[model samples]
Target: MKNIARTLASLLALALTHAPSALAQASCSSDGTPQPVAIFERFISADCEACWSDAATPAPSATAGAAVLDWIVPGKAGDDAPLSAAATSDALARLQTLGRKPPVATDVHTAAIEATMPARLRVAHGMPFNDYLGTAIAFTPVQRAAQRTGAAPAAMDFYLLLVESVPAGTEGTKVARNMVRNMLHGTLDKRNKLSKSEQMKWMETRSMRIPEGAQAERLRMVGWVQDAQGRVIAAAQSTCR
Candidate 1:
């Protein structure tokens, strides 16, 4: 019996060593991420102290199926700015992408995720480790969308966001926020059809750095896919366990 137990343990260890990477890490909860029908983005400058605590700052809808994101654009004050530590260049790029100038204090934008879009986007992340988090996003084309004959491959832009959920009162703010801390971007061309008539999908897995002072437990991920026209096709937000 001792020898049998030893053999079983050895087998188990060997199996684990060869396990798939996905199996080695946790994904979203069993219920999966939120399927947000609309995305709301709030922009604030790190140098603006009043903006952080202002009650007029726009907020995401309380209605279900909506996702809100907060971006801290780097202020002209540079590192000396109050919230400079949380400011990111990605925010600036996003402003450019949206054709919006940086606001002196705060601004808001909204985009809808078409419920009838033919593609699906899923985002997930594993538990944080070593100041890094494993995150992934996948794009899947429905049967008809994938089987379009002789159609040009569609251009797709993928965005994965790592956000810190801050309570309304935590930072003297009157509203809760999903603060964007880190981001990953990629582009893909949709396949005209599934490979060998099987599943055709685009996916990317990456390690996102956890910013200093970010509470890992409060971290979550949001992702969306945009077409060439910059319309959101699908959006998802992770639910951390």
Candidate 2:
């Protein structure tokens, strides 16, 4: 009986040793600490002759943590255009909600740059046309002390913008910039009046039908969290590989 027990134990140990190791599950959390940064959004139309000058102005490779997005309005009395009707409608709605005008350029070098900055937000990934573009974001109370005082806001607005980095337009005489191809917006729950250390996780997934002439490889995403007054509190962006 002792030998039989010993043999069974040896077999169990051998089986365990030969078994395939389980793969670690992938984490959906954002990579690093969320930092405050500005969110710069622009609306432009191809039909407007004045817009070409703004489009001609060189854009920086980076915005110093700011998420920059440009929305090109489609079908505005032009033979050559970039965005589709659906995309244009979506962009227009967002601009209207924020009470902003199109084709207006903002100086990135001034304090006005921070006017619409985001407090702290992280982006997981920004793969465009890869089945779906998705991001996982976590928001913590910026003012936990205010929460204790029962002064914290009940909720915050979040927006995920899908932008396409279009190359110089071969089909038209006009040039193209980093244009916002689509946008998604939602409200996150801050109803609990989160403690200073507590955080709320949110996920946004969007599957986009690539516009006929739009290049999928040049797509990216920008995401931002905004306060009740429409001021962006935090922003981040990811580029597609």
Candidate 3:
């Protein structure tokens, strides 16, 4: 059984390493920039107008080394909802993925990985064409100085988020927010049996639609990896040149 799993993982790794032109076109990346050590997610309901303007919104400090993402969830009011235009099904899906119910107003969750990262996780996007944007996320694990003895997990989950940077005072909000516009999810098999000369890496690429009213220039990509036990292992946010 272990050999079979390793065989499958090896095939997946080969596919990722030799990815086609789609990956070549993925121009924007977080490769050279410093990666964030934590993620701060905020979910707000469209029906609750006050939620957007809430004065108590949590804002991570610039020096905190965290990526903050805001998600506007669809509410019961449908089209009549105040922030309905900005709401997306992806938000609800994310909540479900986290095993949480929609908040009546707003909710915040934080996941912090390490003070000094041991893995490289990057997110990137290409130039937009036909209202679609090419995006990708990659992860490569590095041996820690003090290597642990346990075997690697069989798989890890990845999340690539496209968010619009909304400045403060734009919607009567006192704090700036990186509002999530779209998201891509993937699973990375870590069971590959690699030769000493081979590099073990996992990657996924996709085309994401740019939501209406979302400025392409303001869009940024954020990505994170979670182990099988749901512990975050790495996080990164893109910075366009």
1-241 in candidate 3: lDDT tens per residue? 5445444434432333345334444456686788786888999999998989987887765667788999999999988999999999999999998899988899988888853336777777766665666676777777552245234445788898988998998867878989999988878874332334434566776667788989988888898998877788888887776
TM-score of 3: 0.80
Q: Considering every candidate listed, which one attains the maximal lDDT? A: 3
Give Cα distance to truth, residue 216, candidate 1, Å. 0.8
Rank all candidate structures by their lDDT, best first, as comma-separated numbers: 3, 1, 2
Q: Which candidate would rank higher by TM-score, 2 or 3?
A: 3
How does each model score on lDDT? Answer: 0.75, 0.49, 0.76
Query: For model 2, what is the error of residue 33's alpha carbon versus the real structure, in angstroms, after optimal superposition?
Result: 9.4
Give model 2 RMSD, 1 decimal: 13.1
Tell me the deviation in Å of residue 92 in model 1: 0.5
Count of steric clashes across candidates, in order: 0, 6, 0
Give each model a TM-score.
0.82, 0.59, 0.80
lDDT for model 2 comes to 0.49
Cα displacement (Å) at residue 28, model 1: 2.4
Tens-digit per-residue lDDT, 1-241, candidate 1: 5445444433432332223243444545213455788889999999997898887787667766778999999999999998898899999999999999988999899998864457666666666566777676666767686577434347788888999999988876787879999988878664422255444567666667788989998998898888888888888887745
- How many pairs of residues in model 2 come into backbone collision? 6
Which has the higher TM-score value, candidate number 1 or candidate number 3?
Answer: 1
